[model samples]
Each structure stands twice: as structure tokens, then as C-alpha cells.
Target chain A: MNDQNGLTIAVVGATGAVGQQIIETLMKRDFPYKKLVLLSSARSAGKKVNVGGNELIIQEARPESFDGIDIALFSAGGSVSMELAPEAAKRGAIVIDNTSAFRMDPDVPLVVPEVNEEDVRSHKGIIANPNCSTIQMVVALEPVRKKYGLKKIIVSTYQAVSGAGNAAIEELELETRALIDGKPYEPKVLPVKTGEKHYQIAFNAIPQIDKFEDNGYTFEELKMMNETKKIMHDSNLHVAATCVRLPIETGHSESIYFEIESDDVTADSIKELLKEAPGVVLQDDPANQVYPMPADCVGKKDVFVGRIRKDLDNNKGFHMWVVSDNLQKGAAWNTVQIAESLVNLGVVKKK
Target chain B: MNDQNGLTIAVVGATGAVGQQIIETLMKRDFPYKKLVLLSSARSAGKKVNVGGNELIIQEARPESFDGIDIALFSAGGSVSMELAPEAAKRGAIVIDNTSAFRMDPDVPLVVPEVNEEDVRSHKGIIANPNCSTIQMVVALEPVRKKYGLKKIIVSTYQAVSGAGNAAIEELELETRALIDGKPYEPKVLPVKTGEKHYQIAFNAIPQIDKFEDNGYTFEELKMMNETKKIMHDSNLHVAATCVRLPIETGHSESIYFEIESDDVTADSIKELLKEAPGVVLQDDPANQVYPMPADCVGKKDVFVGRIRKDLDNNKGFHMWVVSDNLQKGAAWNTVQIAESLVNLGVVKKK
Candidate 1:
């Protein structure tokens, strides 16, 4: 670690699923952190977790927890972020939130470094990472939007159980194993954990992701539609999302149909731009049966795009399949990338 | 079975997955039939399957097998249909082919009875069944189309492995069980059974269903796109599809975005129309967390429609989730329905 460049970092929800992935991604990307502070709820306060190499003690996150923290990443649920994010920001740390609490707030800058890097510099002490599904989609379509101008985007998501948190993942596994063994099992944590109803997600697809909104869309779907527009800096962009959860443990796949403003754009030209785009991996060789899948992109840090096709009827429209590890590039990597951008752009305050 | 108003029926691919379901559907629906003749490939000949509590011996399919048959329902592979469908039809039997062979042929009318039962009478000896993914979508959307006049349709399917036949179903189960037990297994029948590559479909989603067509869309995607227009009798309708195979064994779910010509359609009006549409069951109630899911619609005879929503930007556009049993309605029941339409419409030959 370089003491001159490294800054103090605090990770809220250090014991949770996306939280652990954030810690691992920081270590993997060799993120500059002279000192790492791990924080959790009171129930897991004294728990020990291994960092890059050394064991670190988790402390309960509080108003005073961000006393000297330069960068704090929050993945602890929306309520915790609502309660503690302002406290951390007021104490001096620039918070990078992974929940939806501050995302739609006009004061907060929702950032996906590859799609909206400059937005990171405008953050007023807190930068919001876009939703998991939105992050991968924006990463895949930003290049195209920059080249031809995106007019409309309609997406249908095949999301993993892991996006609902670790408990949902365990439920998928236990339910799958039980169903295979011909044993009956009860589902307690799927579709919506807080909602009264739960559905079996193993070997099935549930159309509802989060709670349903009055408009008949799920919160997850709204997050995707809203966050994509914000991150892409296009308020007029037509975006619609149908978010569904599958039994997959990691990686989220989306089938996106987008209409570009230009009439001259072809599928190959879009593929060419994506080939060199930042944070995107082109896995689209349809002749060879090579396309992105959840299992293949589980540990990857880049969004994978494939199945690029020109719409048979609509000349200006095209379709693509985007996939990425929901926990990695979708949350952890995107959050860490934002932190790196802040450090590079001198957005983090000096000690 | 009584001879009065009964027709001798022959089922091609009698030993395969859809063929067995077709036979069962006939009995379940109480179809009029004086005799049942089972025909299969030479490799599957001599196999016996119980039909309506009677053991029917599967016989080798040949030109002579069509003798005295009034109607033949074909569910064998496409090659089998191409070879024997005409042979059966030439002997005065109306061939309801359930393969992709004659679906696009001008001489063969592609039919989804609920959508276009009148198309059944125009069949030149052979009538084609729409693809599983297309069948369910058209069945769900036909009412909307009829009321408002469809303009465009974009569908992304989370299809079941059983659509690929019994081998793919076995592969999903075997691979899932092996993976759950932490054992190794080979995937021989997924993505495409005859393709050069094989991808794991357990705990994953494969974006390619059938083999890739020359134009980047897979064969299955083409089926959904092409067959929708034909069955709906709208050549100018804009249709696009992205087909992906999931580990689900029986039911197929589609996230469909469609546009109608009418400017005055609301989501509620659409729901009301579907509530009264034949062969459709409306399962949309976001408040109570009720929606159409593959697991819930496994053996259902009707297409399940849910999550009806109006597009935020496009007034003419609406989105929905459609689910149906791929083996039941998607294939066998739809095939049997076409047969019943023939009898009801007096399209079948009378003895």
C-alpha cells in the first residue's frame, strides 16, 4: 500500500453479501486504501473478517463512525443508508451508496464510471451507484448511445437470486435441493422478503422482483428505468424494464431492444464500438454459439454483450443481450470504480 | 370409442415428448376419435404407450401408415414432418404438423386456433403449428390485437428445456442433480442438441435456444418472430424475439412489449379484455403479488397473462408477462386444439 496516495476507507454492511464482494473487489483491483474500516450493525459488530490479508474487527456504524473516514461505501439496506449516509457525509466522508435511497434525489449524482464519469465529480458528498441491472445495461449501451444516440430502450431482465441478497441465494439452493430430493420446502425470502407471499424460485422464474408499484411495475423495474436515464444523462430517453428473478446464483442477463436515432447505424458498427468500449466485453460470435451466460460472467468485472441483431422490421432498431456479475461490476466493482474516479479527479477532500 | 362423428387419428412421433402430450390432450379434452394410430421413427418403433387406459403399440411411420387416417398430428422432428406430413395428407388426411418445416411455407397455414381458427380451413392438406414461444404470446395478445389492432411486438422468452424435447428435459434434470451433488456431468442436449457447442443450462440462462440463423437471430427467435405474423395474419406487423433457454422443464414465460394502432387503450382496458378473452387466464394483481410464472402454469391448458402495463413514453405500447405449459398449450394442447377446430369447423374429411 502506498501511504502517500492511499486514503482511509469505511465499508458499511461489511458482513453482508454485496459488502463482502466490495471488500474483495477493492483488494482485487488494488484499490488505494492505506487503512480500511469495516462497519456493520450491532448484531455483527464484534465479528472478525479477513481483509486483503489481515483480520479486521467490524464495528457498529454510527454518526461518529465516519469521524476521519475519507471514503465510505454503504451497502447496508435503504433504511440504514437513509439514517447513516447523512451522518457520514456530515462527518467528512464522501459516501458511495449502493441502495436506492439517494439515487433519485436530485442532489445526489448517480454514477457508473464508464457511462457517467463526470457525474462523479459533481457529487455533493455522496455518489449513488446505479441499480445492478441498470449498471450493466448502461455499460453496454453507452457506446452505442454516444455513437448513434439512443431513442428508446425496452429491457427484460433475467436476474439472479443473489441480487435479492444472500438469504435469497440460500433459499434458492435449499429449495432446489429439496425439490430434487422430492421433499416439500417452504419459501420465505423470495419475490419480496418483507411481503406476505413468497414463491418458489428454484427451477422457475418469478415476474416480480421487488415490491410492486401502483403503476404495475416492480421497484426493481423502476430502478432500472430511472437509473438508466439518470446515468446516461438522458431524461427524454424512453426506457421500460420488466425485471424478473431466476434461480441463477450470480450474473444478470437482460434482453434489450433499443432504437437509435440515426438510420445509418448497423449491428456490426455497434459491435465494433462496443469492442473498444470501456468496461465491456464482447462475447458475441453467434456462429460459434458464444454468448454471455450467468455462469460464465459470475466472477467477471466487465459487462458482457452479445446476440446483437438488427430488427427485421424496424430499420433503426437493434437488439442485444447484456450480462454481468450482478455483485461484481453491477455493485462492488462499480462502487469501487467510482471511488477510484473520485480519488483521481480530486473529488475526495484533502486531510 | 363410438364410430359416430368419430375420425381415425394418427399421431406422428408417438414416442416423443409432444406426441405423448398430444395423445393425452386428446383424451383429456374428450376429442371424438374412433381409432388411434401411433407412429414413430424406426428407432422408436415397437414401443408401447398407454392411451386413455389402453396400451397402444407404436408403429413405424411410413407412407402406408396413413391409410384410413382422417387426420394426422405430427410432432416429430422437422425432418420427419417434411418427409411424412405430405404422405399422410395425400391419403385424404389433414396433417396438423407441429414442426417448423412447413410453418413458413405459403401452402401451409400456420394456426393458433384462438388467434386464427379461420386459418385452419385454408390449409392445403397440411396446417402448421406455431412455435411454443410464439403460440403462448399470440394466444395472450390476440385479444388485444383484435380490439386495438397490433402494430409492433417485441418478445423475450424464458423458455423451458422441454421445448427441445425429452432429451433436453433429461439433460436439465441430470445436470441439475449432478451439479447439486457436486458431481461432474456432460451437457449434450442444450442450446442446440445438434450444434457443435454445448452450454450448461442448470443455474444459468442460455441466450440461444435453437441454432443461430445467418442473420444473428437464432432459429427459435425467428420462429417466434415469423410465426407470430403468419398466425395473426399480419405481414406488416413489426415483430422481434429473443429466445433463451432456462432450466425450467415444462412451462415457457415471455416478457412481451407490444404496440397497438389505437391511441386510446389503457392497461385496465387491456386487462378487462384479457379477462374475457377465450383461452386466456388473467393472473395480474400486483397488489397481492399475483402474476403468471412458469412453475405455476406447468400443466395449465390456457395461456396465463399478467403484469399488464402501459408504456411510460409510448401511449400505444403495453407490456405483459405470458406463461403457458410448453408441453400442454404450447405444443400438444394447441395441436389438439387445432384438431378440434378442424372438427368443429367441418374442415376435416367426413367418412
Candidate 2:
């Protein structure tokens, strides 16, 4: 598949959860590459990953590793992205950073393709991926915005532990078994692991997803509020988020209550818009008991929208349930989609 | 402890989940009664309950059983309450109905003592206990309402399976183990088990808590909407709910977004109001990571409120997280409190 547009692609932090999914999504989609480069922290540098039936050795990620790379996918921790993303961009490689380090930066274009693909063209070398929760939400809401014109959004997320990293998933499993065995196990990973106290995430709901900001919104909540505005290019749109971590392992579900600027919008109108919306699957059939659930959304790239209804007594208000695989559309698929968009738009040329 | 108002107090549905909690709550509060009557359906009727060094045999709840009973606490299913509540009321016994039988019936008062205790005095032989989800919400919001006068509410609930029934809990446990062992398990008791096709609750979230109503709100959601109005006595106030079933077994957590009529209401003022409000535990220390979780609230009776914050750019809007043991404040404890209120207010007197 190598041609004039063929280029080397590097995946930073290539062995973690989202990294693994990004590799799978790229291979399954048959992403074109002249050479595949895998980079990770020194601890996982020597690990090998099989991509499209070919084993690629992961090298330690350093600023010098971006030499001759056309596109770099960074899923490493925020600190790594903060230090290496600029370096990779300075090396003539366009960096699609998946960390929060550059997402809120005014110069960094946040791309969701379905919602803001054109934003990628304006990327100043470093493109930022929206938060997983925000990506799924913007995907589900973009069609509505196009049709009905969104004014305000209040979302409460039933998020999965996988969004907290692989350690949180392990903690959920361990705590489930510990609770089943009637053994006293202290929680060490959920509701912000580095915070003062931890709560078991196995069969409980933790209201906190990220560290609490002084305004009482968690950082995760703030990400949804800020990223939605940036990606939608509407700073005047009112957005509020309550990010909660539940026991689910992969898919993240959100209960979104929104008001449209147009009063002519109905629940069926929103459903119809979502039915044809790209990267959105409308599962709202109340008579058939069809609605999106996290378990049903595992491994899926499409954001599922269901339970669509007009708010009682408010002609302008509507509520919808949205679910998407946090690791897929939320992270990996979105990242790969951005790369694909870059190629289709002819933004990046062959090395 | 016997006095001129000494009377027999009967607890219908005394053997089930919330029924047992009601018995325990009564014992802890030292609820006064000259005689205690325990009644249940024929299946649970011959069983016995030991409460505070007293063992009472469960009797079949027939119409004649209300004889000589001055007060009746009904935590039985809706059918049983619909059948037996009127019989108890006709027999001169004040009935505290915990089911959805008469909550919306304009004639019956839906009372949450903290929110609408004044309405308790106007009960015409029957005082309807608000839905479990509604009780916690009204408790959390009543203080805010008393301080700032409420306007609108939008809530999404993460409810426990125990609210469905005892069998749903068993189904969740068995399905969880089956899923872990890579075994196929048919769900028989979740997302409306009586309807066609049961869904798994293990490591999953079900958006439908009850069957769909004509308004597109699930039965559980409607209960919150209707009961909130009745308890808060605000038929003109806007309310919307999205009820969901998570894997958790006991507590019901609500992500509530509300607007107050007054711009003077701050998140800090709401917190101070809740801290001083009766039966409310303010767990709002985000710095210490002290938000409430269902696991910590499994056996407790207090409604936990935390993550309170004012909405940015909206002076009248605020958000809060409300949680409590669904079986407690949501059902049993609220039922017992109604019974206590009947005696304390001298609404029910001995013959």
C-alpha cells in the first residue's frame, strides 16, 4: 500500500489499554503506513506488539525518536505528552496528542471528526483529542446541534472504570471478588486514586471521576464543559457535567438533558437526526425496550443514542441517553479517525 | 412508655427487604405501640420477626386483620397496598402506604416528613410514602427550597436492584458469576423482569428501571416526577427524571441539576442548609475526597448530600449529588417515620 502519500506512523505509549485499542483500530481499518513505529516508556520499551500480523518492537519514547515520522499518536501520560508532543511537532511530525496536556490550549485544535473535522486543518502541528466522555457526547449531540440548535446541556455520566486506566479496572475486579468473599479490602484506585481516600468501584457508584476543582466540578467535569465548547466552537453554549465512575468496565453512558434554541424540535425529530447521524446509532424504541447500555456497547466504535424523549412540560427541553466504548470512540478510534481524516484531507504527505 | 394514646401498630409486608428495615428502624427509634402486628402475604405469613427482644408472628394480611389496629405501615407491593390499604383505613386504622398506590391520588397526601410534614396532619386515613428516589431528592432539595424557593429539577438516578425486588439481587449475583465464568446466563429479573427479555445487571447499566409509561418516562421516573410534586406541593414546578439500574445493591444516587427562584441561593448556602437540615448528612468535603458512596450508606438511614456547586454563568442554577440507602430513606425508614409522625401528632389515637 506504500505510495507517494505513504508515511511512517509512530504510536507513543503503545502497550497500555487505549494504546492497544488504537493499534487494533488502525490495523482493522488497514491504515496505510510506509513504516510502523511504536514507542513507550522505558519500562515497556522492549515489549513487542503484533499489528496487522507484523510484530513491531516498541522503543523508548524520546524527543529524537520523532525523526522522519509523518504522524505521531501520543497516548502516554500527560507529562510525557507535555514534554514530547512539542518536540515531535518541531520535528515536522504532526502530533495527535491524546493527553489532557494540550487539549485546552487555544492553539491546539481539538478534533472529533464527526463534530469538528475541519478543526484538524487548523491544527498548528499539535492536534489534541477531546476527552473520551466529551468525544462521545459531542458525537451524539452534533447532529442535534445541526438540526435543532443546542443552547444548554446538563450531563451526568455513568462512566466506566477503564477510563481511569487499567489499574482501575483491576481494582474493580479485585474489589468485587473481595466483597464476594466477605474479605475486608481497602480501595486504592477509584474516585481519584491519588486523592486522600478511595472507595470500592466494584458494585458502587463514585460521584467523583477526576480531582475536584475549586468550583466543585471534578477535572473530568471541567473537561466535558470546556472541551465541548472548544470542539463545537461555541463558547456561549452553557454546559454542565457531573462525571461519575461506576462498575462498568468499558462503555461510558451519559444522561444528557439539553435545551434546544428551536422550540419546534421534538423527541422524534432528535431521534430521526441521530438515526442518520454519522458515527451514531439510534437505539431508541421504547415499545421494544430498546435503549443503549454500557455492556451492550463494549467494543463498538459508534456512539449509541437512546432513551430520547422531550422533557415533560418543556417544549424546548429534551433528554437522551448516550453510550460508547470509552476506549474505542472515546480514545483509540477517535485518534485513528483523526489520522484517517488527515490523510483524506491531504494535510500530511508521504515521508 | 404506655400512655393515653397507646395503640396497636401493624406492619404489613414485614418479611421482605424494606419491611425488615422498617422493623429495625422502629426498634432503634423505640416507636411506641401497645401491641405490634406483623402481616404479610400468605407465602411469608407464617414466619416470625424478632424486634427488640420481642418476637411477633407474621399473620396473613386479610381485610379482617386490620381490626383493632390503630396504625398500619404498608410496605407490601402495589397490588397488596391497593387491596389492603383501603380496608385498614375503613377499619379506622391510619395507613402509611409505601407503594405507588395513592401517591398521585390528590386525596392522599404524599409525605416526606422533612419536606412536607405539615401535610401529614391532613391525611384522610392514608398517608402515601413517596418513592424511594423521590424521598431522597425531596429531602435534599427541601432545605434548598425552604431557603431559596425552588423552580426546576432534572435528575438522573443510579438506583439499586434491591428496589426491584429480592429476586433481582439474586439474579445480579448469579449473572455476575456466570459472566465471569464465561457461561451464558439468561436474565430473568432485571429492567422489568415481568416483561419480555431480561437484561444483565452485572458490570452493566440498565437505562430502564421500570416499564414505560404513556409519557415515555419509565414507571420509576414517573414516580419521582409525580411524588416530588406531591411531596413538595409544587404542581407548577418542572421536574424530569431518568431512572437507571446499576449493579449496586442498596443505595440510590441521584445527579440533580436544579434552579432556584432566587439568585441569592449559592452552592455554599445550599450546603449549609443541608448540613443543618434534619435527617441529612452533608458529605461535601471535596478537598478530603469525602463524597458519599452507596457502600458506605448501605445500612445507614441518613440521606447523604455532596458535590454541591453553583452552575457557572447562571446565578440561579446549582447542582448536587444526593444518595441514601434506597431501602431506608427511600422506603422503610420513611414509612416508619410516617408512623412515628402519626403518633407524635396525635393523628391516630387509641380506642
Best by TM-score: 1
Q: How would you encode candidate 2's per-residue C-alpha lDDT over B1-351 as one tens digit per residue?
A: 333457788899998888888888877776667777899999997887787787778999999999998889998889999999999999988999988889898889889888877788887889999889999999999888877888999999999999987888888888877876689999988988678878889999999987997667898898888788878878998999999999998899999999998876678888888899999999999988888889889888899999999999588999999999999888988888888777778776555
**Cα RMSD for predicted model 2:** 1.6
**Chain A, model 1: TM:** 0.98
Residue B121 C-alpha lDDT in model 2: 89
B124 Cα displacement, candidate 2 (Å): 2.1
Q: Residues A267-291, candidate 1, lDDT per residue (tens digit)?
A: 8998999999999999999998889
- The best candidate by lDDT is 1
The weakest ten consecutive residues by lDDT in model 2 chain A span A1-10
Tens-digit lDDT track for model 1 on B196-216? 999899999999888888899
Ten consecutive residues with minimal summed lDDT in candidate 1 chain B?
Answer: B1-10
lDDT of each: 0.91, 0.89
